[model samples]
Target: MDFDLTILGSASATPMLGRHHTAQVLAVGRKQYLIDCGESTQERLIEQKIRFSRTDCIFISHLHGDHFFGLFGLLGTLHLQGRTEPLRLFGPAGLDEVLTTQLRCSGTPLSFDVQFTCVDTTQHQQVYEDAAVTVNTLPMRHRIPCCGYLFREKPGRRRLVKDLLPTGLVPEQLQALTRGEDLRDDVGHVWLRHLDVTEPPPAPRSYAYCSDTVFTESLADLVRGVDLLYHESTFLHEMLERAVQTGHSTARQAGQLARLAGAKQLLIGHFSSRYRDLEPLLEEARREFADTNLALEGLTVGL
Candidate 1:
């Protein structure tokens, strides 16, 4: 029942001290998703003590170098380590060609199979779904084709309260009760009623990831009432002009999005190198959204 977000890097375009680039690891149960594998993410993963073996799926926001430059090396290392499990990667168009070129030039033969899927930033569509979770893409306001991700956990099956069950019920009978299935004796009779034993599944919990993008009001509904939101605050309010010029958002802008979307909490990052201190940015965002928090490396959040 533990979900966490570990920041691998937090700098935009240019690298800086104490900050690497844009990378995040979202841990949901035994699954780990690497989001935006910027340069140095592998090292950061090792440094942060995140288990690389547990990572099988990765989501990339766009084709920017700062957003996914670390993919090649990380994939190469996973191969060198003799990994046999399949790894799935989701990103924008042309990403497959780019990585394929790199792999060809580097001659890095992988032991595990790698699957790549391109995300259509312009479409509001579900990209991946399984029994455990569903991953969807949100159209974003960026200079290039970019998208955000929304992870929604699937509802759990009805779990029977074991202690409340009638005594001496067979284990198979208990499973049938949990599945809302009726049982029959050798003489042919109803053993369990769906209404008497099972309850509805719990509501799903969700997390939304918004990468480098402007604060566009159109996205408010797509991420409305999300449990947690990771938004890019590349500049402060004073740098509104720069933010507009660069397709970035100010701290206040990020806060406004969080507020309008009705998100429970906001984690802000993807800071510009010009800013040395982040306290002012945090202050500016916190002023508008009290649940706002700075996104730092190794900081984990329960989704």
Candidate 2:
């Protein structure tokens, strides 16, 4: 039930002031999955007290330097730290070549193996899966081939109420009830109903990530009804023309997408360096969608 997202950096295009770039950590239970290893992500992880060894999977949205510039450095640091566990990486095609070329030129071989999966930016497909969650790619319209990620938790088994259990029922019978199945007694009579003995499982929660994309209505269907959504708002409404030209979104546009997608909550970030104050962006988004928040560094949102 430990589902939350922690932001590491939230700047866009260039690093300025105290802001670095784009990176976040999604923690589901004890496992941690990294999303977009922007510059200084390794340091941020250490600063946040997140164990790098616990991170088994990484998802990179695109080949943009601000999105993945820290990956090679993190890999080399893991090598130096003597990490032995293999890491699975999902990213757009050519990422493998980029990383391999960097490693080869530097003559630094990692101690652990990096299993890479090239993602198709044009398709909405299942990219990664485990016992806890499933990740799907969300096709995005960006200046380059880019995509977002949808993280959906798996449904858990029903919870049994001990006081409601029948005395004669054994562990097997209880387990069956937990799985929403009815149990029969020796005489083939209905001994216990699943609904009578157990409570329904907790609803699965989801988080969607969208960044560096133009304002596109089709994105609404891709991330529909997520518990929480993180979308890039690199500019304000006054600069809508610039947003379109650069393949980025304005704060109002980000909120519009969240509203259209029926998201429970919207977290907006990737602010342009020109703005010293971010309240305008937040206010603009809130005007369109009341449940909106700024994606600041070190902020954690629980779902």
Candidate 3:
């Protein structure tokens, strides 16, 4: 199974000279999930060569323009492309109402159904689950109703040691071994034990996306030991007061949160436009968390 993340946009509040807004695409196996559709997100998707039809779900962290303004355009483009599959949309309350208003005003009947799920930003709960992955909401402290998302890959079956298999074993016996079940003969005699023939499954991988959130220590508990963490670093530590006032986190704080959560890798993005040079922000975060990296547009990370 392949787990990858592609950053589409990383600017905070507004688009900059070289950066767009906040948006990303997370690929879990064959399923693709869109997180935050900021302005020009469709263009970014096109640039990345990710087909729109492949994206079955879209998650909006909050109602801020920088986070979800591109959703209307993306939905409209999907209709134009003749997409008929139902698209599942998860977001905070009032999102459905706003989307409905946009559709009504434009008089564009979509070809596909938009199944909306309103997430409670104040609660930590499992919001979506499939055979390959599970998505949970991480309550965040922001100016408005907002929440981050935690994506976890499901555990796979045990692997069998081909050399240890008995001669003339049927397909059913192999399947049973993968399920951790002992194989017994038709005469009720134990042929081979599962533990001797199979190895433990690979450990599950997890990724956390925290966007436009203020410094919250409680978040560390929710995403402890995540393989990858993408936290918003909208300002440098010198501007900590402004970051707190705007419900955003500084680069150093983002690094500290990553360290506290025991994340394996940290990707810091959602940068404020005031800083033309981003090396300073990256350096600041790296000082706190040595494995921290800047989340740039068109960058893909594999887990």
Candidate 4:
């Protein structure tokens, strides 16, 4: 029930004072997912008191060193700690080979099952799904073959209005009534009012991640109307040209993307080292979208 997203690191490739590289921890319904682990990601987890054993899957946006350098160290630590739970990784092509070769060269052996799936961003299909949620890849404009991710929880069962029911209703009858089934009496007459006994299911929740991408308008179509959105804002509007050159988005652009996508809330991070203060970034983003917030390391967004 505690669905949230915790920011671990929010810096670009370059490391700055008080800023770590890219990493995010998405705590879904009952599982934690590591998104884009950068350098010292494991250290961040320890600092936040997050158990690495809780992470069931990892989604690497791209092969950029800043986005995935800490992966080997984390894997090594997992092996050393004797992890037995199955771990899955969703990344771009050749990620399986890259990680396998790294582990092979380092002579680190894993005690658990590790599965890797290559992401083809060109297609907008369901890449990973389960009974609880379904995740899709949202490709964006970046220097490399980077793509965003969309995490959506499936709709669950409807709520039952127990107080209105009679006290003598048995558990089996209650179960049938909750399932919208009509209960028949001895004479075969309907005894339960399905409409009056049940409430509609809540809306499905969704979170979209758009990190380390340039100001690409195409992404709006994929992330539109998302419940929450985390987009990279590496620079202020003053560095618009630099942001474009480096395949990054300015704070204003990120806000615009969020607004264009009709996101309920926007989280901006991946600050440039030159920025000693983040007021300008916040100010620019607020100009476009008033619901925008900064993605601080310890900050959490409950969805």
Best by lDDT: 3
| Cα-based lDDT for every prediction | 0.88, 0.93, 0.94, 0.86
**lDDT per residue as tens, model 4, 182-284:** 7898999987776778887777888888877898888889877999999999999989999999899999999899899999999999898888788899999
- Candidate 2 stretches greater than 4 Å from native: none
Give TM per candidate: 0.93, 0.97, 0.98, 0.94
RMSD in angstroms, all models? 2.1, 1.2, 1.0, 1.8
In the predicted model 1, the residue pairs found to clash are: none
lDDT per residue for candidate 2 within 1-303, as digits (tens), equals: 899999998899888877879999999999899999998889888888888889999999999999999999999999999999999999999999999999999998889999999999899999899999999999888888999999999999999998987687778877888889998768988767899989999999999999879988998998899999999999999999999999999999999999999999999999999988999999999999999999998899999
Residue 44 CA error for candidate 1 (Å)?
Answer: 0.4
Q: Candidate 4: lDDT over CA atoms? A: 0.86
User: For all candidates, what are the clash counts?
Assistant: 0, 0, 0, 0
**Taking the tens digit of each residue's C-alpha lDDT, what string does model 3 give over 1-303?**
889999999899978877999999999888999999999999999999988789999999999999999999999999999999999999999999999999999999899999999999999999999998999999989999999999999998899998888788789888999999998879988778999999999999999999979999999999999999999999999999999999999999999999999999999999999988999999999998999989999999999
Error of 1 at 3 (Å): 1.5
- Poorest stretch of ten by lDDT in candidate 4: 156-165
Model 3 / residue 129 / CA error / Å: 0.3
Query: lDDT tens string, model 1, 70-162?
Result: 999898889888999999999999999998888788777788888999889998799998767899999888899999999988877677765
